[model samples]
Target: MTATNVETTRVVRTSWLPLIVVVLTQIQASFAVNALTVSMAGITTDLDTPATSVGTAITAGTFGMAAFILLGAKIGSRFGTRGVFQIAVVIHGLAMLGVALSVSPTMLFIAQASSGAVIALIAPALTVFIATNYHGEQQGKAIGLLAAAIPAAGVLALLLAGWFANTIGWRWSFVLMVGLALINLLLSFRLKRVPAQPGLSIDWAGAILAAIAVILLSFGFSGLATWGVVLATPQAPFEVLGISPAPILIIAGLIVGQAFFMWLRRRAHEGLPRIFDLRVLATGSERAVTACMATMLFVGTAANFLIPLYIQVVQGRSSIETSFAIIPYTLSIFLSSTFVAYLYGRFAPRVLATAGFVVVASALTLLAFTVRGEWSQAFVVAGLILLGLGQGAIVALVFNTLLSAAPKQLAGDVGAWRGLVHNLSGSVGIAVASAFAVGILASSIATSAAEHPEISDELIAQVNLDEVNFITNEALAELLATRASGPELDAAIAVNAEARLHALKISLLSLAAISLLAIVPATRMPRQRAGDLPEKLEPDDDDLIDPVDEQEALG
Candidate 1:
């Protein structure tokens, strides 16, 4: 056979097989993670925990995911892709079972943290395998498919979780994940072992420092009130690692970590992997990808987290009704992500992202205008649809840009970085929105109290402005019933309206500004043809392989 013919045949064999495995694994993994959210309320009730405590547990997963992603990358480098992935899959299954069995909230939280790290491992290795196996448009499509899988999983999760929550309980809902994990494991056997680059010893100092910085910063964001309380009142809430309002201290640690890691990398000739790879951040493409991912999460999360509260509290809807109301967002995310992904292949990522953000910002503006004490289902659906479409477009564009910008040699590490940015962005976005909402509510309540001299300070302090605003105005209605005169009721109504509107506007507008941040970085991406490169016939031929696999194959 001609040399060209042999090469062509090998390329065809290498590309399609691994590509399918990567896309499927990513989808399944995403589905597993998203499934948890659907049962969150149930879990809170079962564990007898407050909503805020439950939120902390969920956010802890992000912290663990971000903190250990580099560790996963290092594992992949040392043990090879297949080894790390198999181990991660097992860990995932075990963690799910552990979570399901937990009678104590602490145990469940720990289980989630462990599963988070496992996810970090699996995701990076999957991306590395895909990057090595596919090129050009093939690669773009594979990533797009992964992005689409997120919402697909969300749809499945919400449906099943809701059903299971009603029939069995939240515990059983988590238990169901074990079966999915086993199926994923069975399918994972088809995945080929990808080789690791040699001479990549893990940088111990860098790893520790980076992990510390990430955990501290993530906790800081997740526990902003704790941090803020520490700042505002010396005796406020609990402090972690003896640091409260430790923003300055945390920032200092991050700088030190960066410097130490850089020094270690400079001496990499002596054998240090430099786990976080600060050099990657220096590149415009990497920064753009990171920013784009963060911005997408910022807008999407704000919209998603807020609307459920709005429906349940403001509109006095039931849990089922609230979920149904938000279905538009979930449905639109799946459909829009799939559609926009194709568009991303045809045009510059910037174009899609910019247009999407504008649509979302416009939706938020409309929502701010129409969101009232009484809202129609149509109005809520319309806003959700707009938000969903915009998020879908943003997600597709960012994933496409990140993959294109990443170099093949460092794809695993880059993938880890991408995951880190994605989760961190989500945590920070939600935190910022929550903080702004709380601030607005507090300010409004203060103003309301001052105007209504009849309302006692004790009553004002007892009122959970945050919980009440998020819940049905029925809570406010109870308060209003105390007043007999029409003018008194009018005053209360005006105060409530102003407070809710202010909170919603600030949340939406802040997210809009965050989305705008993505526009600048996205412009740096090259408008490349999607699926322009042919599939690889033998992707793993060049990747690092497990020594055991190498020896067996040679035999």
Candidate 2:
């Protein structure tokens, strides 16, 4: 290109409208997930299903997205981002309607899973679009806004779902998602399109292998709260060497996950089409971004799940109350995310990301100590502020790093990787937190019962303390109502309360330890300040490879 053409391209002002539309996609995706958490009680009651079943719907969404996100990248590369995004938006809208109209648990599963699949097609489109359309400071700002929008949408979803579930119904929360997707679909018409790679081929073998690994891992994680993690529980259909089947599934997933990497290597050396480009993660900087993304997501998802759980299950409060409790935390995330991106200019990723991890760990530790049966909201809010400040800043920095490092052509691959990281981490985080909390609850109850004669062994045996169960005080009272009476029953109830509080504190401490461990990886991040020019990947010549022939190779 001549200097004149380069000057022309540089001078062209990117429209903010397109960025807004792309950000909407980010917002809508996060909103659906957060809304489901706050709406859990209403959905389960309406469908006459167990609470775990309602939670599974969320897990199923993550599985569906993880399974197809890589393929979504291939589809986008073949069909064009703009076309796929528009069509995906339409499909998402219809799926949201199915979700809202679900009459049974079975229907809810189908609707949520379908919605997740369609979302995979659109999720990658937004990041790729932003990375392709904007550059330099503008690109940095766009990535910041996208990160902020997720939490912002989360706040909106919680508030809306709370209000709707209290007044209209939980179903309307989904109806709102349909409306948002439709609006985005209309706005997407104005987006700039890339010419499709007509001969693009899908790596079906690698795709299937990766998908199964993700699905098994995700399912195992989700079941931790229902099925025992190590020892066999009643819920397990069978046991291996007297161990719970949940851990077995997780072990299988890890082996399959290794198999996926091996297959990718074999394909690369054997001259087959690679599903995931190894080059995207060739640098330490890119890997740092991935590490930071997973760590922050795990902390964030675990915290988010715990908040609603405490308000609804422990405190016996309504969904609206859960939203009210989340305001301080969600608000902090939104506000901090808006300003955090500006820090990139002055601070290195190593410094910023490490500091972010520290803040999160400290906040989690604070919650662990301060939380009680009758918690003080003021202390929780203070901790949330600290958590949000760190989380918001790190998300922007890591995202901007990836965008600036890679060339425009690899935008689809970058998005696919992001979707995979987020979905997997989120599923794992929620599952592990739930499992940890429930495990503690059962153990604490057993220990207290064994020591205190008032809460006798006979009384403990009446309840299924061997299984994973996170129930409200009300539920405990109701369960004991039929089986016990007098001071013994009352003592048992007191023990349950103490056990519940102890479980929450211990589980939060565990999460804090994980967040602190993330500091080790964060230290390896690039020391370059955000203002420095990134080593950009030069785009490959698109005309060199045609997908029509198997022998035609990608440079």
Candidate 3:
């Protein structure tokens, strides 16, 4: 049988069940991350660690995924997609179980990292499954559903995990994930099995380079707050020639990252198997789509992290309140992601993307100016809704553009690239936001205290201002109660309050600036509507054989 006939037969046999399974897997992975965010207060209290520790755990999971996702795509190609996906599902469930049983910060980080590494196997396989089982409009809709699954998972995690944390315990959230993972595994039997490429060779050297680069970057950024941005701090584990190791690590990561790309280019020149296909990003439009994607995710994830940190940690609110506060935002993301496909035919991707970034920047600016200490302000809700609408639209649009730009054979590469950027940008976003906010807070507190008459210079000297971090008003009060009283205590509390709010405003404004800059990339996107573009076909599309045809040939 001809390859065209084989493709036709496969499309004819496609079912929505596979899409459902894929979406569920996405939810399962996303829920783990979101649950950690919601349960931050509980985890910090239970583990006797600071909130930054929990943030570090979250970064670890994303970092692990970003580090290995390229290798994972190749692994999916070498082994059967179905088999690898099934095993990944089961392993992820075990990881979730480990999270539920974790007794320390180290244990939590290890468990989350394991879950993330396993997700590397599942993410690319999902895209390959859609490519093999669906065609044309169905494929588009499937992609939309898959993109929507992230925010949809966020909504579920906020509600369910919040309730679990408030009532039973935070650990129950991952226990629930374990149950959901089993259900996802059971549903996997219904998905179409895509044949593996036995001839595909693994690029172990390239994988090592990529992994080391990502790890260095993740740890470096995450440590900036504790280790000092530019100078060495007392909290730093070690100094490099009187300089903070954080910036040094970041520089090393960049150099290693450049080496990894150079290695890939050399491999491409030699016609050797590369870790990732450079062709996926060969065009200007494709590179623009990637830039836009990374920017939106960086801004969105930073906002997401900052909001919860303020609500639960700084404000000392319950998980349930934090969940309810962001309902409008998460719902907007779900709605926009699900329905943005309809807008594709009416507007060019560039128009939609530009408008999306504008909305996001405007929303962030609104948030910067309007947010006080209160989470219930009408403007705050409006800002969140607008932010979600813009973020969701841009996310869906970019993913659709990316998938359409590549041929079916490179589906795994596309998926891996998308996953790498999505998680890496997100991890960096959270790390940078945390570091920036804390850095600002420390500086603001010192300045405010020095200006206050009641807060004497001796009092400031007694407390290590350099070690300052985001703390609740109540905690600050308790800490100062023994040394300060009456006017002094009041002054110290006021300084903390004002400094926290100022830090938040500055962070939001910074994010808004990033959102505006993303518009430049959006302008470089394709002017044509995604639906109007023709499908990109591989050069060997006619010569390629499907799994069934190849099996027949072997027989």
Candidate 4:
């Protein structure tokens, strides 16, 4: 076809229907996780399990996505993007149904895990569909919308799941997801079909290695609080000699991760099909973009986790209260994600990304000083709004840059790598934040107790300070009720309150420091405007050459 014909074909094929379908698919995946978070109290009450069980379920879901996302991308190419997406959506809905019907913590953990694994299939296909169906600016806007769906779903889950848990039950939240999944599956028919590359071979060995590495890292970080950060605790299931299994698993994960990369280089040398496309990260700019993406996600996810912990645990507030308190932040993220595309043509990626990190650092510093006792304070609200704006812009900008850097044929790999980084970084962010905050809190409590004249060292010996976590003043009083009375009880509660607040402030400041450090990577992002990037491959051109064959020829 002539250039004019290709232009005409592109316009004719571009429809908002595909964007809507993919965005809804993203919303479905995001809503499931958010709903679980919002329904934590109800799930704990109904299942008669500790809150940590729900946390385990969340970690399990993260592990599932991180471990299988690379493989999921390969699966999408071997079959067809649309077909695999449809099947995955159906399976995810079934997993949600299982979540709704779960009677025990184990059931909930398995169901959420299944949902996450299936999302690995859906995530990559969303990017491939946009690449196949849109061009130029339209493609940029589509990616922004895709990024927006995440916080939009969070807002929806907070409102809907909170209301459902309060009135009917938490189960209704996932039931609603099942209904939406059905609608999304119906809408899947409208998406453009990308032909399957049946000749593409699966690298089962690399897939296993990647899966093992992700699982080890996820589990190791997640278990730090329970299994002990450096040494074995009484709660640890097993220990290596006297050391905690957590650190051992983390070290092993790093070794295996290095091996996975070496194996990929070998595959490239031999001209064999690999699990992921290394070309996506071949350039310095591309590597910098990846760093920027991971840093933004780590800071954003950590802030998100810390705020809720403070709201619900420190202040002894309800889920509904916590949800409403975060509305400004979530809404700001939605607005920024949707409108940031307009600025892409005016500014280079490096400029936008650097500015974004600076804003985030400033917001975190403000939050560290402003947050005292309440979530409704004006300064806290301002900080959250600022944080959301910076985070939303960076998330959208890096994604657009990474996608634009690669050929349309490698979109699946780009999408896969993005998914892996998003989940893994978020998991580590929460883990580190939890461990750091609790460690500080524990140390503060011990020092305060030692200094207080009313408390005795013998009393401290009776209680295990190492097992302490973030809890409300009321819960702390109940725990010490039998051991101490009158001024002693009062002093312990006072110590707990002051220590928790101090720990929170320190944590926010530390996160702010990390955000400031991220500016270095943002400065190295691509210097070109989005419009200056190469035009997207035409639809007919996409089907003409296989990505595997193209890689071999390029080598």
Best by TM-score: 3
Best by the lDDT measure: 3
The full ranking of all candidates by lDDT, starting with the best, is: 3, 4, 2, 1
Name the 10 consecutive residues with the lowest summed lDDT in model 1: 545-554
Error of 4 at 313 (Å): 1.2
Query: What lDDT, from 0 to 1, does candidate 4 have?
Result: 0.82
Once fitted onto the true fold, the runs of candidate 4 whose alpha carbons sit more than 4 angstroms away are 1-12, 48-53, 529-555
Worst 10 residues of 4 by lDDT: 533-542
Clashing pairs in 2: 199-547
Across residues 252-335, which tens digit of lDDT does each residue of candidate 4 receive?
Answer: 999999999999999978877778768778766778889998888888877887787787778877777778888889889888
Q: What TM-score goes with each of the models?
A: 0.81, 0.90, 0.93, 0.92
TM-score ranking, best first: 3, 4, 2, 1
Off by over 4 Å in 1: 1-28, 31-36, 102-105, 132-138, 195-199, 226-253, 260-272, 276-279, 312-319, 373-376, 461-502, 529-555
lDDT of candidate 3 over 1-555, digit per residue (tens): 999999987766566788888888999999988888899889988998878778888988998899999988888777778899999999999999999999999999899988988889988888777766667678778888899999999999999999999999999999998998999999998776667666677889999999999989988987887888889899899998889998999999999999999999999789777788777776677789899999999999999999998899788999989999988999999999899889988887888999999999999999999998787999999999999999999999888777666544565677789999999999999989989998899889989999999998878998886688888888888888889989998999999999999999999999999999999889877543233222221112122312212122111
lDDT of 3 at 33: 81
Give lDDT tens digits, candidate 2, residues 1-555.
999988877655476877889788877777778888888778877997666666677777877788789888777767787898888888888888988999998788788878887788888777767666776778777767877888888889879998898889999998888899889988888777766766666788888888888878877887777777888777777888888778888999899989988988887677667677655665665677789889888878888887777777777778888887777788888877788766666776678889989999999898888876554567777887787777777766666566545434455576688888888888788888888788888899888888878776676777777654667767777878977788887888788878888888888888889889989878767543234222121123232221121111100
What's the lDDT for candidate 3?
A: 0.85
Better of 1 and 4 by lDDT: 4
